[model samples]
Target: MPVKIYHDEDTDITIVQSKVVSFIGYGNQGRAQALNLRDSGVNNIVIGNIDDDYAKQAREDGFSPVSIEEAARQGDILMLLIPDEDQQTVWNEKIRGNIKPNSTLVVASGYNVAFNLLTIPDDMDVVMVAPRMIGAGVRDRYVQHIPYPCFVSVEKDPSGTALATCLSIASAIGATRGNGAVGSSCREEAGIDLFAEQALWPEIMAIFREGFNVLREAGFSEEAILFDMYLSKEPAEIFERAADEGFVKQLKYHSRTSQYGQLSTMNRHDGKDIREKFHHILHDNILSGKFAEKWSNTKWAAEELAKEWKEVENAPIVQADERVRDVIKPDRKK
Candidate 1:
């Protein structure tokens, strides 16, 4: 489907400014968004936790903090900025009954609603304003007056103004400043985001590790292997440039030999096979809810994942990375 992009001119900032906005968590998104909203002249704002360190920080930052239930009851817009794993519990225990009737319920991500992890009442407005970047990036770009494009979606709009409200919020957070915001569906955003996380990133990391290991096992020095694999800033700089400019434009910045080698050898990798495998993984794990089920049920999922990741940390490549960094970029330590 073609996406409709909305800019600041397309949004009525007063819509959000007039509403009482309450943030349900003080994590990355919460802090950045709440600050942005306040700075954008939305004065009726509150934090939904009163006991946590983040809550204290919010208070210190000059915002009154309340309990989740109170915030839900009082605010016209309740933005749930908590982790996906904890959203359902918070909704059932503190939000469902207490939230104002016909008010807006906002989510930064559509994971819970897309997967039916939480149910919304028909009387309320359910919407999402998912930023394309991290919370810090959102705030930084907002400060710089640059557009940080976001995905705006309306799941249930009983009041008939959910999309407008979403766009208003996006504008307040500086998402609709330059390039504006992309209109998308909750399911689309959730599926794409989850697929990227569960399939794409893991595949990339696996390829990196396997390539490094192959070179190391073939008698290449760890220092040389690390440099070629990633420890050097050259690949990182190329990727950073590619993100801002198109990959084709980025290619022009590379040496002719580098560009020719990359283009010519690209087909040597089994691109079709890798894509098929990724599709299978996405279908079985993400679309089928297997991954969510495992994550929710596994008692020590984070710890186990950390343990699994220790292999990369303990690898000789990383030790070589330290040595190389010490010589090439010693100031990085500070």
Candidate 2:
């Protein structure tokens, strides 16, 4: 027999919606999540920030905006959607001191709690409800009447109502719209989210950077190469495949002739030139203690990568190419 677990729409919404929910932080995850939660009729919500733009935005969107202390005091359910690194400090300074003894502390990711950066009081409820996508995708998917899947985990449920409350909150924020699947556990949810995030972006960036460098060293214009990759042929074809169908369906969309063309292109460009360097780099960075040291320091790897990207973006030919593309946007749309 299949495992019969507990969850459904009839599960109480007012349980969480009635609680004074305070969201701390106002970045990518924070902004989208706070607004989405409010839009779902979670009216007893407070955003923890004094003068931040998200506070302003939250107020405009019909949420109570308060200082972190006041938010913590007023909030029976405190959601920590801040960045991984900053969570500990925030918890120590703002949240831990002010929270009601038996209140709930919700985290979307598990870094601080998993790594023992933030230790919860034994009396409080600790749970996690993590959406499986980034901010834009999460927002867009919700707007499209497609609720993204979420992982709900209850680590320490003193009241035994943590799981139910989390599921209720999930339902409130469109987590059950189109094929919505919600799974259980704090450790499991945190681990999976962090692992996927840590692996995918660096791997893709390393691949792109190496490919761009190799093409440039081979005397091809980086602008020409990226244009072909992004706009002209490669991206267009990929977009066509993805838009027509899902990943498996994409293979069906490609004719045998198209398959042969792909094989030919791979042989000519990708197979011949691209090797295991990106994988090697990824392994080295992760294993060589470099990634750890960088993380432990006050460094932002994504920002640094963005600067390198901006350098490539600032190349004169690249600028001109972008301008030309913009000029033809109307034609492309037509």
Candidate 3:
């Protein structure tokens, strides 16, 4: 289905400005978005954070940050901007009970909602304004007058105005600046995001690692191969160009020979294994909620993360990376 896409003109900033928007968690996305909204004339915005470095940063940023429960009590619209894993706990303890019965709950990630981890009051509305950009990028683009993309969704609309309010928040936070805000669902948002981490990024990372191994086997210098692989920032430039231009059309920036080599070889390589791997991740893990279930297990998650980190630390690439990085970008344990 062709999804509904809302542009600059579709949003009314006044809708959000009229409501009290309390940001619960003054971290990356939280700080960026709250400042964006305040700058955009949403003066009634509130910052809710615990007594931490983030709260200190919030104070430095000019917000008189309050407790989560206090903010929840004050806000007509409460944005849950903390990390996904922490949301359920925070909601159960500080937000769900203290928040007004009809207050609208907002999130920048669909993880908790998509996995049914949050216990939202039925009397309240639930919406999402997920920016596709990093937190710093969100603020940078907003300040530079550039636009960025975001996903806006209304998961629950008790008052029937959840969507308008959601889009209002999106535009206020500069999400409607670029290609506009994509109207999507929580499931689609979470599924695709998790799939990229579980499937797409893993494949890309493995490709780089294996490519390094292949060149190493071919007797390439560790420093030279590492620089050529990524340290030269060539890949970053390629990706930036891919973002600015169409993925295939970005080939215009490359030599005709390079373009032909890439395009032709892309076709010659059958991606049966990759396709199957991605399908398995999407179907058996992401859509089935198996990944969420596993990750939600705190003990298992912590253990798995520790094991993965140890594996990565012991990987051959890490030593090569440290050696190359020390020479290229000098740093010390001191």
Determine the backbone clash count of candidate 1: 0
Better of 2 and 3 by TM-score: 3
Model 1 C-alpha lDDT per residue in residues 21-139, reported as the tens digit of each score? 98999888999999899899999997998498998889888988889999989989999999887788788889888988889989998888888777688889999999988889988
Best by the lDDT measure: 3
User: Model 3, range 1-334, lDDT digits (tens) per residue?
Assistant: 8999998799999999999999999988999999899999999988899999999999999999999999999999999999876787788889888988788999999998999988888889999999987899999999998988889999999899998899889989888876899999889899999999999998898889889899999999988888888988998999999988878888899899999999999989899988998999899988988888878767778899899998898767788998877776676544
Which model, 1 or 2, shows the larger TM-score?
A: 1
Candidate ranking under lDDT, highest first, comes to: 3, 1, 2
Go through the candidates in order and give each one's C-alpha lDDT. Answer: 0.85, 0.70, 0.89
Worst 10 residues of 2 by lDDT: 1-10
- Candidate 1 Cα lDDT to native: 0.85
Q: Who wins the TM-score comparison?
A: 3
Q: What TM-score, over all chains together, does every model reach? A: 0.91, 0.74, 0.95
Better of 1 and 3 by lDDT: 3
lDDT of 2 by residue, 25-105 (tens): 766777777767777778787788858777777677676678888888888888888777667667788888888878998
Deviation from truth (RMSD, Å), model 3: 1.6
